[model samples]
Target chain A: MSQNNLTSVVVGNRASISKPRLGLARKRAIIRFLFILPTLIFLAAMFVFPIIYNMIMSLENYTTISIATGNAPFVGLQNYIQLFQMPLMSQATWNTLEFVIGSILFQVIIGMAMALFFKRDFPFSTFLRTLILLPWLLPLIVTGTIFKWIFDQSHGVLNYILMQLHIIHAPIGWLISPNMALISVIITNIWVGIPFDMVLFHSGLQQIPDELYEASSLDGANRWQQFIHVTIPLLRPVLAIVLMLALIYTLKVFDIIQVMTGGGPANTSQILSTWSYTLSFQDMSFGQGAAVGNIMIVISLFFSYFYLRFTKES
Target chain B: MPRQGLRRSHLTIIGALIVCVMLFPVYWTVTSSLETNTQIFATHPYLITPQFDWQTYRIALQTQLPHLVSSLIIATGTTVLCVLVATPAAYAISHLQFKKVTWLIVALLISQMIPSVSLDNALFIIFNKIGLLNNYFGLMLTDCTFSIPFNILILRAFMQSIPKDILEAAYVDGAGDLRTFIQIILPVSKSVLITAGLFAFLFAWGDFLFSVTMITQNSFQPITVSIYGYISQYSQSWNQMMASAVLASIPAAVLLILSQRYITAGMTSGSVKG
Candidate 1:
């Protein structure tokens, strides 16, 4: 039955077939194109068109007033220049880098620890591992809200626990103090991010053959030595992918900071994404907002180039 | 091996402790929702609800029910539409020989890194010009910007595993390309379809940036926007706010519980394949 079907399919593809069959072949190609057309149209309209429009909008003097009047005059590089001049822009840039680096470092470290710890099979290890993914799976707004309450100044669980342990003399303003607000959001972000790293590294660890570890042990290697020699070397690809992805994702983070601190304590926690939002919606400077947004895109593009490079290399 | 058994039990206990610490925030959200104003502000916090309390939930539901329904509509609409557009595209990408398909896949991968704010900025203008603003259909369509490419990537990965011979068999039986996809491929790709649809639903349901940007009306606001709104309005009412947070999380939590396997498979495969 299979041989018969294969022969028929092969014959159907022959160019030497009848003219009528040639028509059928053309029709099949058209049908295949039709299958992909809707997706193409959607992407063109939503993704491609908007990105081009965004670049155009960034060069114009667009604002809420201009939007209403429908006359956004072209001002080449003016918006970009203004973006540099804005005081909050530099602060936001620094905060964005800090947020990304701080969150990624701790998330990777803690996630690696958790992954290595849970590498050993034990009763209910799988169940516990799944439970830890709760933070990552929850909506960002939900995570933000939960953390907002957890870091509440007076009645927060963090401060309460610290006070109970006699670790602090007074309630620390986790989200209220300017010096601490960015740190607070980063902590929340790290908590949300750890599970992603953990799961990815967990799977990566599972892929390394057990024999490598056994051999290392047989060679008089301690557990730490085995991990350094056998595990780290083998996990490099997964590690690079995880770091790049975490960077890209963290750089675009908005909801967590927006909800937790509103980039608050006087813009100390403000990042690029939220700053772009404030520029467009709150400040009514749509052109500058688009420029700020374009800046973010450039930064993301830099990271994405590396991401694609790493994924391709791996 | 005998001594290792003792260490394994010790590791399990330690793992349990770690999980407890990590999930404490989730637990606190639930308990805080049940606490009274006095209990919430007490110098010492109650680790558990002192008594059974549902007032916060009652109030939350009374105000936020419409928003939840709005979320359900948008999420479901986005999921259905995303799967519809992406499934056939995924099939074509996997089975058809198109020179440009590789470039298209690269574009799709690049789209994942584009910030939602940038999209929202341009979309706000375009949607306004086209009069799609404040429309559920419009919002649902925009939500697909995130989910459709993701669905295509995942579904294409799954579809590539479907043996070419089976498709050829269908073709030899005089089934058209669409027919082969519908009749032969769709049935086999059921699990992936579910995974893709579930992710689309979750993405749309949890969306905040698009919701705030596109829908300016209170009536059209999804639960995320409503919850954010509730925070500012009822900033003093922590219990009610926590109640709303818990309410907003129920769908995701329920899906996680019921579809743990699919979620894990989807997350792991989606990352690895990308």
Candidate 2:
């Protein structure tokens, strides 16, 4: 349904407004405007104001000390230049790409597999599908806490299981060893992301007719061929939506990382979100934090353009 | 037919197994919370809680009760405010012709793209000046930034499908706009309202970014921030730490069970509208 398309026609609703009297319609319109006024003011105050304020803050040399002094003088681009100069900036950029891409890759693949498997309507399939959503529904802090212990260097459940399975001789430092820190967080994200992708994918899959599968098989298409040809092509719209939404979700993923590692061990696992937080809160450097935050906004806006476009087209 | 039936049963077994593995961590959270310190810190932590213990949970509850109450207040306040503000707007935009609808929609989408960290940064500055630091009202306002837009959209979607004749009949009955909304639209739209309210409550309840950014004082933190502290302070007491995490997740679990369909429907309609 194009109902999801916000810019779609409002023919039915618009009709009600068509034939009201000039004076009464004016009155009605004013009332309706009044209805939306609360939301308008709220958005302007909470959202638009903060965005502009963040931009202004990014240009200044604001810090905690400035809080007491009341002296956050504007230093144009100084914060951005400082951001670029930091060695952590480049590492975080690379880490964000790896984390987002890695998490999306596995989440989609594994999620797609689960969605396909669950398409075979069996007993308790619906309940099972819903049950799998616990990970997605749980508080991020809980997930992070659980995974931290599971990924502990010594005496961790994951390591114990690996050794028991003879998969490895020694316990792997999943959250330690800066090299694997990002990967560990990515793994935790994938686990959390799978159910979301699966639910959406399954919804998309349900829209495809069983007749198409039957027809494809009758035309000598094998199961693998049907999936590659019929299923994949039909799922393009969903694929685009899922990928974009996942991108947004991954970009906003500050809680789990903050809870799990706090971008620790010399900031090895710091992505832009966590790094912005560290600069703003922990180090009390508001300018650098807002600068990092603005960079992420730029990135989000770029992808959001394409995302809204795809949503419009579909 | 017999072979197909056999395989279907086998698939059931496999599905159950997949669930077991997928949910092991959640299972571990509960079991670990119940286990003693010795049981948890072992080379191989027990997969099951053999000896039940409520002491850790008691200790966690003692420490985290205020935070829980704070989370409840914020979440409930967000739900109340989001519905109160967003409903009238959603009803107006969906039922009436507003030229500003498109702009509002864009703002909603763009607001979603603006990272919470930036809002946290800016809000921190504003809150510092306004003395809203560690304030429930400020935190509720910030949390509703996400909730209000989604509530408006989801509620509007449902309101749009509500057959105009139902509203037109109310208009014919000499009922005013406010009266019509209160009498007819509100009654018929109960499910959507509940769904939206639940989503709002959960979003605020589980919120960490805003809670952590806005509220610095440990005593006034939400259960989320409290549990984050619980992790560090009780690092040795894994039971209490994990128990606190479990305590924090109660709202999510309860709501998920109580309103699974509404939860999923809200989720999809908020994004990929059906």
Candidate 3:
């Protein structure tokens, strides 16, 4: 009887101790949940919701009319199909590819040159380096506007300078000519993007130890040889990152193009982003616009995947 | 030694020349803003204004001041909202033990890849449904979508560098998580908070895409949209357009000059650490 009583007492103690501990754990979990709840909720409403809604809109015929009527008829794959049929689609796609390629190519080359140049510590080097970032610091609209005037064919400073130097007899249309418009915007983009690339490369260059350079010099390697073998190899990781980021940023470029050309001169300068905007906002073809946006997202995702993989490996 | 000194001086000259070339466009905008309409249209490009004219600036301010004010409010609101939301979440993600933390991080990374244009398309429909269209609150909220993820990532990176012992000491002193965060974490993170806030400010300030898409009303338009509209409307009036562009660029230029270190740190931290 005493043994049974002791056993009952131990069981009662165990249950009583376990109950509050479980409750405390639940309380802690609730508190933890509260901490992240606001961010998760905000992201859900903003990021996740919009993306899902975009996908849904891409599937349906969700035009301004459908929006007004509150009746979006489901038409699976039709919008995507119609996207391919649009004449501007191929041009915009090709232009986007060209823009990304051209912008990245020149930005990296010029930026690398600047980085290598600035690596030598001359007087006012820091001040000059900071000053070089002015183009990047200005808003894209401002850059676009300035470039617009700078390339103004007849009275543009570019023409004035070229004419003064007797480089050309006739004024060259920088933004007006169809063939030159894409190149003009690419030049503007390159200017805006160079500082960003330069800054990253500068940081990367700073990371490479001075000892390595000294060692290369001791082995009778000239500056060019050292740069090719030592600097290039050491800078590869930073280069990969800079190139990927530049690609991603350049891919979604819209402000400059919109301000400069609005992807005009017969849609010759149209990229997927501006074309998407034209389709949805201007033409009110939300479904096709969303389809184009999805296509962009897919492309960005592909790059992002490589970025993630690259970063993981490095 | 003298020859080496001369060579270094030569490098300085070259650097100065490069800087001048880079900054010519910026200088042109300012100078053009101060020039007369006739001078702007002259065949011979005047490096300096023929005559100084403040009329363009006065006109730009007269018409576009309201838009600048709107931009200030929207940018300020976005920064405040982003910091408030991001700080606690960053604290939790970095310090707290949670199973879904990795998923939240992955979500944050993936969110950056989601294009703003795509978000704008869907947000228009949703905001329209709920009467958020043409509203400052709605615009600020949408801007937060971009900054929040970025701010959280930045703040979390900073927060992780804080020693665990300091936070643990607070816990041992009978402080709760909220108090510990406010008293210990926030004070220690002043610099990073400022960095993150500065970036958020710049992001919203320079935003043309969201401002154009979200608010169509002229009165409610941000400076970016206003300047864009001004340029389109006054295509022939180069001076007036340049004046507005100059006006719009001041905030970014000032921030770049003042807090360049923070900006550089914030930018590199995101990519390098990732």
Compute each candidate's TM-score over C-alphas: 0.96, 0.95, 0.94
User: After best superposition, candidate 2 residue A75: deviation in angstroms?
Assistant: 0.7
What level of docking quality does candidate 2 show?
medium
How many angstroms is the interface RMSD of candidate 2? 2.7
TM-score of chain B of 3: 0.95
Candidate 1 residue spans exceeding 4 A from truth: A1-20, B1-6
lDDT of 1 by residue, B1-274 (tens): 2124357788899999999999999999999999888888888889988985888789889999999999999999999999999999998888776668878888888888889898889899989888999999999998998899888989988887787778766765778778888888999999999999989999999999899889999999999999898887777789988998999888888888888778877777776677
B117-220: candidate 3 lDDT, tens digit per residue? 88888888889888999999899898887788888989988888887768766765656678888899999999999999987887888888889988988999
Candidate 1's docking class is: medium
Interface RMSD of each: 2.5, 2.7, 6.2
Worst 10 residues of 3 chain A by lDDT: A3-12
* Candidate 2 lDDT, A1-314, residue by residue in tens: 45433323433443355556567766766787888999999999998898899999899999987788867999999999988998999999998999999999999999999999888878888888888888998888888999988888886788899999999998898887888888889999999999999988988899999999988878888788999999999999999889998998899899999988889767888999999999999899999999999999999988988888887676
Candidate 1 has a DockQ of: 0.63
Tens-place lDDT per residue, model 3, A238-309, is 999999989888888899999999998888899999988988999998988899989999999899888888
True contacts kept of each: 0.65, 0.62, 0.62
**Candidate 3's fnat?**
0.62
